[model samples]
Target: MRSKRIVILTEGHTNPITAKTAWAVLRYRGGDVVALFDTTQAGKTAGELMNVGGDIPIIGSLDEVAEPDALLIGIAPMGGKLPTEWKSIIVSAIERGMTIISGLHDFLSNDKDLVAAAEQHGVELVDIRKNNERDVSNRLDLREDCLRIHTVGHDCSIGKMVTSVELTNELKRQGQDAKFVATGQTGIMIEGDGCPVDCVVSDFVNGSIEKQILANQHHDILVIEGQASLAHPRYSAVTAGLLHGCLPHGMILVFEAGRKTVSGMPHIPLTPLPKLIQAYENLAALHMPSKVIGLAMNGRLLTPEQAEDERKRVQDETGLVVCDVFRDGSEPLAAAVMNLRAEIFGTPVAS
Candidate 1:
């Protein structure tokens, strides 16, 4: 039978017993072990791991251990003291889908992004600071922890727009006060290197748009949208910005269906006038909201006809002012923001 791969890490010599004990448990379970010894302690710590069956595959550095199945990082006082390079090491693990068991103090201070990324992938975060002193076995079952996420949308989808409107109307039908956020061409995607793509560009534009939205900050829920390609390079930038900005408090990722392949998945096309508005409404609901009221629309679609429909729908459903970019005669996006009630900011398209 093939053995499972398990990785163990210790801060310094004080926790050699803890390190050896943790390693022994895994080895007893028929698992292969790779241990990373933090030798930051004058050289005494490095000598200890070598002392006890010491020839264990000692990783001189965190970078040395690129990939591991499960990582047991001991947050010793000495071990917790780290250089910046350690940040990348943990991020790389999260990217590769590793189960990381870390203490609360270790997680909150050192690897915050790693913790978020891990939670994003549904990894369990164990706070061992207080529980480490207790029997690991007895405390494993008590996983009562508070984790909350404030997700915000910076893109749009067709169905999402309609859904936002529908949701708003439904809320009003229930006699609840509602608020929403809507803007034109407010989506972006920024690359790891700061380049722009469809979703990325949309996200970038929306970052500023979000700031503008925050100025008003009157909505209970917010959603944004994009067209054709959902995983367009731009999507990454926008997603990162929204996650970092922590606005709107929810998110909805929208892509066109039957239009193009994004990240190897079929997306719904965001063309036509009406569905574009619907997409805007739908993307509005992707994040958690305040007051838990209704929904709003945000995206770069909405033609003149779509804008008219959206405005009418906004009036009927939300009973609040609604607007679109299509009637503005701006760069044609299958919809113009021109209308008697709405304002346009760019050059008019020659019909």
Candidate 2:
């Protein structure tokens, strides 16, 4: 994939977090962001709104923007229905020769009008979450030949995917053959591969993960992107399926540092890090043995001093490596993963 110049369409959406598609592209692939199309947030910059990417202009519509390689619809609305208003914009982008990249479960490619428009204009529509409803027939045979790490989180959108992507990038920097297995729509869009576990039926959820891991058997380290929280009542089934399917040898528990309660389920308070990791490890034990190497703390909301203090506190309490995957990078976590490889497989990270 060559460097893509893209504009994100978060039109009619408000919250930045639920704007999952936009946030992932901005946080992980900020360099590609040429502009943001959000009528409500028009005229502002992504820096002012999201506070990460620096001053990417926010436009009122696709008409206001120039040519872009892609137009990304990054909103994952509940029920996954494409808004009627966005439909015209999709057609307009296609007519202008920009490929449409959407992460919605309601695949834009399936829309007859959108399809015709793209074909007429010689553009493409890339739908990440489409065709995930098929059954994965492979038997559940968890592999142990390579080093595997699953990024579990305290809640949905708690930086699990970010941890996996960042760790994979960090390991590759050290010249290791690390493969990232994306497990959700955002991860799929980022990697251009992997499954959306939530879109699969409960019966095939584990199979979905198994298929991804088995395909990457040649890699030295398989950093699988995890989804949801074991503590989240609503989506824990998906989480459990991922754990059983991948059967990771070690774990990196992801969390937003200093969070008081789990997102969405505010009634259920955040679990203590040690207990949470214990629960995750116990679940992982049901399939194959695993241990948590460290914490991938999302310290974006914390002050630098507060983040350092919290990182020190977490390490002191848990006796495991803790790193701000964004700020601190994944060096400590990568080193811990290598150490785990030696402990479990009696080998270094492929030398």
Candidate 3:
């Protein structure tokens, strides 16, 4: 019988640890492991492949690697910090229509171009961050958690607070093992002191940084909260690519008063401005595909004029399917995002 093949896209050294680990795991699970590298100076590369021995095959680049059941990406302990080194291997794999699992840490910085390249090729980006969710001390409060958890910059909001919390709880309940960390006003919780967890969270701080950590570490899922959509559209898409291993199913735009919505690209909603002025160049505002639809949620308080203008701005900028929340019913923002994906891809929304 043919062995199930799994490809590991990584630099030279650190791959051995993973290569051997994967070989053992796959064998136990009834599969195989394959290693591919463009170049490796670090002694780690040879050691790992050798450690895994004959079972795991080592290849040169994405082009040389055969199709596998899945692709696993990681940073080589001895690998250079730059993500670009692994670009050819990553892009080539995705272009060939292979399933991918990536390390978020290096992926965001080193493989950024490859990330974009992967999306263009319609490859699904999977986050290994959840594997580390348990790494977070449950005893540690949110504030200290944020300190330990590195963040990028701070600008933008994550969206509705109630919705964000609920989603966090749901992820936990589902045993998806994702970490729900925050920034901005609602940033991580510290001690018994009170902090504005409701302020528009910053994606630069939490979402990007956390996702990278989760991916680099190879965790399954990592949930970054307080990131507002439209704030940093590219980073948002990048985050989506890092975490979910694909472009965000779609983007969400929300309006809620006194709520201080966190905004970024992808899942995060933008700031709550009365008039969300939008214009379009050749590309979508957030580098989203033309196929993604834009939707509006009234938050049940917008005037007719306000709603009309919001609708117009979204329609003009995205050229996507737009739906009014008031008309669409009060589905939670996360659920709404799933619904939009279903409508576009013709797949049933995973309830």
Candidate 4:
């Protein structure tokens, strides 16, 4: 059977957080992308603008697609609320016999108009975030066979997902069986499976992650994609819950270069990289003999000189291998993880 054709809708917002959901589809599910709908980035091809979309068209609206099997609501808005403007577009897609898939807190399946339109058109409405509370039966304990490398970050949007994906691919390239366990809405969208911890209620978030870890037990290494920072007030519960939920063997600390405060909140200053890394290590040590093995920095917004300087500074501070995953690739970071693997499992990750 053929994969369903999907078109991501980004609309006017293209900031990293909002665009991240579409980024996952582009990076991991590009084969299914029929087109992208982001008027802000309409003219450029998906590959030119996104992390991973190869030569796909970017249209202004759903009117451009003759037909699509599904329309993925591709923005994790400020509050995960579906934009008021998006309702009309969603209804139109449903009317056109397109199933709607969303990972938003505002459950599209529960919205009366959306449900009615989907039923009327004989299409399906899938809210990946909603209706999954029962699947989490238990918070299983960590596995002894699989080495879980949880990617924690200094702040939200600090390259956790990108680093996790890149490192997993790098390990696979070296013939080390690696798996990515996604935890966010975008990661779930990209992997086609994962527990959206932010959407999961507090009591069940850990149970949900525990369930994912138990299900994916085939790989040698599990590169679990991390979530919000423990420093982030609004989302610290999720960050801490996911961090402890997976019960990592080690961690890769990710940080954005030049970010002084938690993304938008300037009132709270960011702790130094060494301090933040130590905090995660201390937290993980509570459950296991875990420490941060490497560093991943998002240096895209920084100048080359600034990026290099920060990398060197962080290396000095943490005494760990640091790599700019986007500009320099994940080899340095991957090597660090591989070294840890060798120490634990007595194996080399190379040809």
Candidate 5:
């Protein structure tokens, strides 16, 4: 999948928040992304819109791109439903012999028109969110030698996946045997394989994530991507399941610096960072002892000064290393994880 020449369809929504799939793929797998299809933002490079995806052109239509191997749905909205207006674009891509890839909860395989069109064109429709695993959690013991680091969030879509990926990459850069265990659609896409834990049945959520952890336990470190916040009104169940499933040794708390309300739910105010930190720690303590080792701030909405100030405030209040992994790089957060690992397991940090 990483080798395929892919064009992302972001259409009208092409910002970092809305078009996170496009942004993340470009950030981690830019070589595979040939172009992005966003008519509203056509004629501009993705780098021009977001700070990532250097020089990748944004095309208005499929005809503007030449011989792409796949078309990825690049936006993940609240309900994860496919926009009605994008059907024609997807059909057109299928007609042109490009495989369709989606992460929406509304499965493309269930759509009659898409299925018929794909059959006619002899192209595949890959739904990253589709899961068939029926395994239930058995409280299986995990590998003692491997260190599991999980990312927990204050609200949904606050950069847990980004923080996990960046930390894993940084650990690898430092010569540690680290593996990223992806738990969501974006992370799965970036890693090429992972269970969309959020999509699995409630009974199988823990088992689903445990399967991935066990599979990757050969590595010395497992940086697991997280899902919705435990404080989230609608999606907290998945968070609790993940917390119990992975049983992380340490966690990095992620939050958008100035975000006060739950995303897409303005009426529900976001839980404070300290309370969220406590809640996650308390929840994890039920199954295994785990601590919040650090904080990863999503400061995209804040200016440089404001971001820095918030980082300091968070650090001062929480007494943990705080970093915006994208802006400050993952070295500090990685170092914190390594320190925690060394403290808990007496593991030697690589020079």
Candidate 6:
């Protein structure tokens, strides 16, 4: 498939958390992103704003973009609803013959005005969060020959998807036939194929993820992109579904350094790393024996020295291989995953 010259619509919120869709797209698909539309951050480069997309122009309006092929709704706000204020911008882009790509729970295809405009311009409205899978969990056995590694997080947006992607890439770099099974909209966008398990029906979440696992069992390893944390108060169901569904042989625990509370909910204290690890392992053991093989720390908020210190401290405390996958690299974590594969299969991965 040909890459589209895309422009992201992040408007007022261009920070890393709120504009995470933009950040992931920039991090993984920066080559295709022509510009970012953030009025407040206009005239600044994406690198200056979020330190990812190097020198990608941040423009104030669609007019600033020169015949871009698509406009991605680059913010997944709370409730995943489309912002009413951005309706005009979306309509304008559709009129200009740009495909509209959205990852929000609110489907742009259902919006009458946007649909009309897209039809008039002969463009597509791609809602990445839309799910069509209806299969229930068959509880069928997964391939024992293929190792499945799932990324479980301590909190939401703590870098589970990033860690999974990096690990998949690193495993492939080491000559393992690895595949990343994306379970969220951002991951689906980046991988170009995945079931947005979070959007699936409550009863179908397991089936949805199991479907992904079954399809990708051909690979030597599957790095499944995780959703909310198992410790999350509100969103733990999705995490539970992922755990039971994937039945991973090994897991990577992702946590942000110095995070004391649940993300976005300050009143709730976070579960300790040891307890969280135990919780994940216990839950996974219900279906199959799985242990967290390593830790991926999100140290974006910390200085390099602090991050290194935290890595050493966490490793010493948990007795697991630790890495800030983004700050450092996926080498340590990838090696840990490969080691788990070797231990389980009693064979070394071919290079």
Candidate with top lDDT is 5
Q: Candidate 5 lDDT, tens digit per residue, 1-351?
A: 443789999999888878999899999998999999988989999998867898899999888877899999999988899999999999999999998999999999999999999999999999999999798767666779789999999989889999999999999998999999999898888998889998999999998888888889999999999999999999999999999889899999999988999988999999988888999999999888899999999998889999999999999999999998879999999999888888988977446
lDDT of 6 by residue, 71-157 (tens): 999998878999898999898888888888999999998899988888889989999988777888897777879899999999998
Q: Count clashing pairs, candidate 5.
A: 0
RMSD in Å for all candidates? 21.9, 2.7, 20.9, 2.4, 1.3, 1.2
lDDT digits (tens) for residues 73-138 of candidate 4: 877776788989888888878888888888889899879999988888999888877745555445
Model 6 stretches with alpha carbons more than 4 Å out: 1-3
Off by over 4 Å in 1: 1-3, 11-32, 37-50, 61-67, 75-88, 103-112, 119-123, 128-351
| Total backbone clashes of candidate 1, pairs 3 or more residues apart or in separate chains | 63
Error of 1 at 283 (Å): 61
At residue 47, give the lDDT of candidate 6: 91
Misplaced by over 4 Å in model 4 are: 1-3, 15-17, 39-44, 47-54, 134-142, 348-351
- Where is model 5 more than 4 Å wrong at Cα? 1-3, 349-351
TM values, all candidates: 0.26, 0.89, 0.31, 0.92, 0.97, 0.97
Error of 3 at 282 (Å): 61
- For model 3, residues 1-351, the per-residue Cα lDDT tens digits are 122466655555333333332332332332355544425532233334544334344555555555565566534222213355565665666777676664343333234775686678776665332122212212212221111111111223212332333444554565534344432222221111112221113333223443334333342333333233333544454333222221233333444422343422335544323233232111232543422223333333466677666666756655544345444432343344445435554664344
Candidate 2 has a TM-score of 0.89
**Candidate 1 lDDT by residue in tens digits, 214-328:** 4333433233322222223434444444333333322322222222333323463224333433443344345433211222333234455665665567446544333332123
lDDT of candidates 1 onward, in order: 0.36, 0.83, 0.38, 0.81, 0.91, 0.90
Error of 5 at 28 (Å): 0.7
Clash list (residue pairs), candidate 4: none
Minimal lDDT window, size 10, model 1: 186-195
**Model with the higher lDDT, candidate 1 or 3:** 3
Query: What is the per-residue lDDT of model 2 for residues 22-140, given as tens digits with 9 covering 90 to 100?
Result: 88888778888788888888998887877666788888877676667788887887667888988887777787789888878787777898888888999888877766555564644
